[model samples]
Target: MTESSKSAEAVWAAEPSTLLRVGPHFRLSDVDPAATPGFDGDEADGKRELRRTNSELADLQERLWAESRFGGERSVLLLLQAMDTAGKGGILRHVVGGVDPQGISIHAFKAPTEAEKAHDFLWRVRRELPAAGMIGVFDRSHYEDVLIHRVRGFSPPDVIERRYGMINDFESQVEQAGTSIIKVMLHISHDEQKRRLSQRLERPEKNWKYNPGDVDERMFWPDYMDAYQAAFERTSTDVASWHVVPADHKWYARVAVQRLLLQTLREIDPHWPAANYDVEFEKKRLAAS
Candidate 1:
């Protein structure tokens, strides 16, 4: 097996939670991502798991949409963060793939524009915050302020230190305003990432997805890993907890996301809007005529 595979194998064997630093002094070891019994291979297994998870996600989402129709008092936000090839795209695809497009909004944060930097870090993020009863997803999020910016020395040490508290308050306010935040860190082995990158290079259609810069970033895996550990500890809260999913086996990652989303949506449990037919009034008018 490759190093990534070994990392995953090691993770599976780690303490109850493979990722110990994910939550509030809580290890994420409690999660069991081994493919369910009778499941197929890694490739086909994900598809099968997707089938069941999508159905439940769709049903719950439909309820949220109908609830939103009448206006719910609350909403949800999901943040996806991981190293490249950690399966964020696939998680978004499989987890929210069946959700109502109208009730769900996805925002991807890329290199910032001058306008974004002109305002506070949370300024750009606040605009896309989900409305009541809606589900908003960030492919990457404001955590970059602390993660990439800190690691790359984009900001001074004092300024970087200031952001940790700022971000905590920022998320806390959103939660107080009725938007529950769910943050996920997709963890994968370095070797697996190399494999995925190589696969992209060998495939003609996937050439566009290949970025030479990604390889450069991979060189500093230790830095990014440390950055993540710090980010999760400082930012994860009772209101905005982080779920770290192993991504070396893409199937396992998908299953973890699937379960998490289903649980969150069920917690929201928005009711369907009541239909008003008014057929009785119409029939009386027709009879009189």
Candidate 2:
């Protein structure tokens, strides 16, 4: 095998969660969106590794679903938070698409509706939690209450400050209910985001993704960074930790996230449940018939 392939194999053999997980003193500013961290692979190698692991990912997902059907209470929730053009859609279409669709539920949160705004921010979120034995994905999660609300001043400063603790409590509750949360922030550079936005404008096929409000949000990039940094400090808890993946390189980001999922599933270690009924009795009855 080529050296790059050897390196990629080593990455798979190693613990990716240790490399990517957010620590108590983690700083979003310290992350470089272009760096690959634990993987020494190039784009081609990364993509190949991602494909190579799909079967394992699929198998683990099927096992989780099977275990759930047999009264297993465990489930997994992958919360993806990123800026516009940070490739959240690509992660869903590529990484997540590799798994069985029946075993997954994906929810993309947008601006709250009139009815939704009438209740607490997490009220809508609770309704979308995945059932036992399934995997749940959130495109942009309750972090928006602190992120955009903090940047845009939708909520008062004190209210937004309170949400950090509230979110920690909420996540702890979810963990107690048997959902393992894997929170990831797709970190991208300012120039990379601008380049992606410009590409969308330049390509007729990508025009639909171009939003005028995206430019409006770009002005608050610094504020958003501060908000995310604060979130890392307050909410990256033992129940559910945050992972920052360098997303300037889409291939690396995809591979890193795939590794994260693999790590979590392996830890959960759901097995193909033992047959509850007698196989010999069923076979004998069928033969008699």
After superposing candidate 1 on the true structure, give the runs of residues whose Cα lies further than 4 Å from its correct spot. Answer: 1-21, 26-46, 275-289
After superposing candidate 2 on the true structure, give the runs of residues whose Cα lies further than 4 Å from its correct spot: 1-8, 12-14
| Winning candidate number (TM-score) | 2
Per-residue lDDT tens digits for candidate 2, residues 1-289, read 8996576567554555888889967878889999888886678888888889999899999999999989999999999999999999999999999999999999999999999999999999999998999999999999999999999999999999999999999999999999999999999999999999999999999999999999999999999999999888889898899999999999989999998998899899999999999999999999999
What shift in Å separates residue 34 of candidate 1 from its native position after superposition?
9.3
lDDT of 1: 0.75
TM-scores, each model vs. reference: 0.83, 0.95
Candidate 1, residues 32-106: lDDT per residue as tens digits? 433232223466655665675676678887787677667566788988888888889987787777777887899
Worst 10 residues of 1 by lDDT: 11-20
Task: Assess candidate 2 and give its TM-score to the true structure.
Answer: 0.95
Model 2 residue 51 distance off true place after TM-score fit, in angstroms? 0.5
C-alpha lDDT (0 to 100) for residue 165 of candidate 2: 93
Clashing pairs in 2: none
Residue 218 miss distance in model 2 (angstroms): 0.4
